[model samples]
Target: MVAMPEPSAPLSLRHRLAQNLRRLRLERQWSQEDLAERSGLHHNQISMIERARSSVGIDIVEKLMAALGVRASDLLD
Candidate 1:
């Protein structure tokens, strides 16, 4: 299981999502542009998401999950 953040310093959901997204992408040796192409999102959008600068919707999340070959729980957990 993944470890949780400490009570004294909790990570926001957006931040966690960004970190997880970046991690998974890197694990696949995929660049932002690569992920963008696979996910049908703009590279800028992928950058914004990896930087936690955009509010992502369920549709976007689904696209990303599909492109990454991961389940929602994999991203969310």
Candidate 2:
């Protein structure tokens, strides 16, 4: 049998951004629920964002950053 190449990681910007957001939030000692309330987004939405299962808009990103007292660049890191 022939071997297949390894699957690549997600290439979407949203997925990458989500990963950064999750890390920042955790570093700040905030739970998904806390981030959701502070960001004005739903808990599931934050969960989905962390899981890279959903897309996010710039506005939402800004809101989350503001609530977390983090810069947008931080979330993009």
Alpha-carbon RMSD of each model:
5.2, 5.5
lDDT of 2 by residue, 1-77 (tens): 22223358544666567778888888989899999999899999999878777777889888988888988878876
lDDT (10s digit) by residue, model 1, range 11-59: 7787778889999999999999999999999999999888878889999
Q: Quote model 1's TM-score.
A: 0.87
Regions of candidate 2 where Cα sits further than 4 Å from its true position: 1-11
Cα lDDT computed for each candidate against the true fold: 0.90, 0.80
Q: How much does candidate 2 score in TM-score?
A: 0.79
Candidate 1 regions exceeding 4 Å error are 1-8
State how far residue 53 of model 1 sits from its true place (Å): 0.6
Candidate 2 — which pairs collide? none
- Model 2 global lDDT (CA atoms, 0 to 1): 0.80
> What does the lDDT read for residue 5 in candidate 1?
64
